[model samples]
Target: MGADTVYVGYVGAGAITFGAPNVLWNHSERIEAILRTRLAVPVIVDPNEARFKEIMEQKGNGDYADSYKETKWFSSPQEAAMGLDNETKDKIDFWILAAPPHFRGTTIEGRDLELEMIKLFGNKANYFVEKPIATTRSDEPHKVAPQLAENKAVVGIGYMMRYLKVVQKVMSIIKENNLRVMMVTGRYACAYKECHKTPWWMKSQQGGPIIEQATHFCDLMRYIGGDVDMDSVQATTLEHTEPAGEIGVINVDEQAIPPEDRIPRATAAFWKFDSGALGSLTHIVGLHGIRYSNEISVYADGYQFRINDVYTTPVLHVRTPADDSKEQVFSYPEDDMFHNEFYAFLSSAIKKAGKPPLPTEDLLSTEFLSDFADASKTFELTWRIRDISDAHADKLLAQKAASSKKASA
Candidate 1:
């Protein structure tokens, strides 16, 4: 909260840190990497002390544990906010809202709470929050979106994939070539059975696989193909007690989710972009670990471009003339996209303050990445898919109920 130092406030500590059950979800390493780049910055973290202590114990008496305990820790965000004076709050430079997507009040209310915490900063501090931007379809992301611009703070949604070097190179090519996009296809498949443990298995908690995990590809699809028309979107979902079972089988515990609330094992969504480009996304919670393919392919007037495994190892391939006539490949073997993402944020924060000088890449790259407004559109599309699928299922159930009553009569 000072001219010489930046203060960071973290909400929902463990879920954003190494404490998450899925190590893939952990982002402590990225946060630590950011801290190293900035000088005299301190983080105030709020979470259950027991979970923090558990993480420390799990790491043994190593440097990580020692570093974990060094930050100012509190029990919860409310307690920390209450303890901080206005002057201290003013000194806060950044806020990271990393709470679990589903916990704290489902995805909708929980995300609202995350934004509410940032609003506590008086909209003066730059903030970064985790993705799937909104939890529920009903959330009015548009209403709060203007606050970021009014506050003049660099607010970013955690779509770190946009910062990948390979992605950047491909974007550069697309920009330089002035290509007209025709269609975009994306696939995000993962082993949710292994990654999802407890609360995550519930759709109410996590918004299902399409909203929570595959959203990265959804964002990418929009990024490459441009904005989508909400009404033009059509989606279908499939869930089974036995994925390999009969197609018409229907089984559920009494008074449970009525089929719509179940965590879908597979989902396919299609939508038309404002550019008139057709976009389609398929997400399957099958396959384990790196064995699954995560890629986004774009077909333009003169070229075919793709980013394969954007999360793990980003490899971009380009086929010019749009016919696979000539092929080119670009690989980022040591891409630290998370580090790049934070570095961009810190750079933008510093630039806004005008106290320090940093590289231009930071400012330029962050400028290119999707902010709350841009990411909100993609979130809305994903949420709409779930809503449409649920409505269809509900209609079927109603029809079935009427048929049963008539038969009994």
Candidate 2:
């Protein structure tokens, strides 16, 4: 009780995933080990799932190790929340809302859980929701915008790449170069197709792969594009879902939902930003990114920045003039997304009125993800990026120009 040991709890620690929420059912022990090793904190497991029992089962063919047998467990998240007293809760600093099933393949359900958690932890300063805060619609942020304005509670929707050191450097270069975003393209893929799901995510009830899985890149696209309004949007999904007709599926099944329509094998949405920046996104199945990587490429004033395997320190291929063509590996200290991401939430919640770890304006990051999810499920979304326009967007250009204005003046 002396100085407040930040006893943060992972609401769904067992749901630690691979790539994008993939290893949930099995990686709890390993994830905990990583957290313990890296963050200097114990990541306790807490879930009502039968999978929690596997820790103490045995280490033979299908069992876990002895050390993990002691893996923390709880009846529910609320119980875990209540266990942290005022002193502990105050020190808790940030609440990480992980749990793969909650966020996987569905934005609406994920948002519902987020709203529920929001209501549950009313006074907490920050909470982390995974990508695609809303799939069916993104007005939720608009709904909560009041709370943000009133209480100033910051919500970090796990767009961890935004915090990467290399990305930050490139963004600085873009801002410094007076460059305008002319064209942007991105592709996010996994090694295999979205073969199966927890039933909830695949159906329209939860949301679809685009929003749940692909939202990460969508948000990154918007982030790199300087938050311009997404316009002239159009996309198509793959008939990859088990039940082909399910919306948003690119390579899972072939049957359509409502047993009528036929989905495509992938989806692409092409649009223009308010900064006259054009964006094209392709979220497909079986087509992994570069080197089986995740990629986002941006073309601007005679230059380009390609970020591949964006989960970690993405390889930044900067294309400049013949003499200046150099591939600089931008450095990022916070290699662990989960750790830095949570640290950001901690800073935002504990230190109010400062530069937030995550954006507090309009939940734009998650909304970008929501668009793809919504697009896949509903097959179309009327909602597009709101504030960007080509007219007086000269201001953004001015920001770019001002960096070099003195040199030219």
Q: How large an RMSD does model 1 have? A: 4.7
Which regions of candidate 1 are displaced past 4 Å? 1-5, 18-22, 25-28, 35-37, 41-43, 51-71, 85-87, 102-115, 147-153, 192-201, 241-260, 288-290, 359-364, 393-409
**Superposed model 2: Cα runs more than 4 Å off:** 1-4, 17-85, 99-124, 134-136, 189-194, 198-206, 228-231, 236-263, 286-293, 311-313, 321-336, 347-409
What's the lDDT for residue 384 in model 1? Answer: 86
Candidate 2 lDDT: 0.49
In the range 1-409, model 1's lDDT, one tens digit per residue, is 2354545566766655564655565565665555543433234454578765565566446434444443555676666677776866776667776776443212244446545565556667777777756555535666557765666646678897778888778778888988788999988877543453544546777777777777788887888788998899887666554354123312333135544456666778898999899999988766644466788898887788888887788888999975566689898687788777777776666666565544455213744277878877877877888778667656666787899899999
Residue-level error in angstroms, candidate 2, position 188: 3.6
Query: Each candidate: RMSD to true structure?
Result: 4.7, 13.3
Among these predicted structures, which one has the highest lDDT? 1
**TM-score quality measure for candidate 1:** 0.80
On residues 173-274, what C-alpha lDDT tens digit does candidate 2 reach at each position?
788888778888988765434455433224354444455555666666777774545346655444333354234433434433552222234556677766
